[model samples]
Target: MPLKLYKKRYEDIIHSDLIDRKKNLKLIQLMMDMESAFSIPMIKNEAWNERNKDVIQFFQQVSNSRRL
Candidate 1:
């Protein structure tokens, strides 16, 4: 569903005349980067695994510090 939405938005950008070629290319790259970041394998390995516990704890500490 999300991929469908992304594809639709990508097609719209490709067809739009409002943005210049260079900027359009940059936007497309950004979208691809976002897609890669949210891919299932990356999420499962980097986010859901116990190997990243320290990383998660560090972020939690930073968040808690900001709340104080």
Candidate 2:
């Protein structure tokens, strides 16, 4: 999916009341951790690395905001 659409869906999930906040936060944290793991230099690919970086940064911001 396109980044813009993915972001929209992410925001929807964030705002939705269907899931427990703690669970959602944990999921986000897991996503960020997974992204971080993929970023290791030994296996990183240039083509999609920037996109992964963007996703990791986005998740970090979301996680921080949710904590506050």
Query: Which candidate has the highest TM-score of all?
Result: 2
- Candidate 2 lDDT, 15-61, residue by residue in tens: 76755766467556555554555553435466565657776466455
- Give the range of the ten consecutive residues with the poorest summed lDDT in model 2: 33-42
**Candidate 1 residue 43 C-alpha distance from true site, Å:** 14
Collision count of model 1 = 0
TM-score of 2: 0.40
TM-score of 1: 0.36
Candidate 1: regions farther than 4 A off:
21-26, 29-33, 36-68
Number of backbone collisions per candidate: 0, 0
Best by lDDT: 2
Q: Model-by-model lDDT, in order? A: 0.46, 0.57
Candidate 2 residue spans exceeding 4 A from truth? 21-53, 62-68
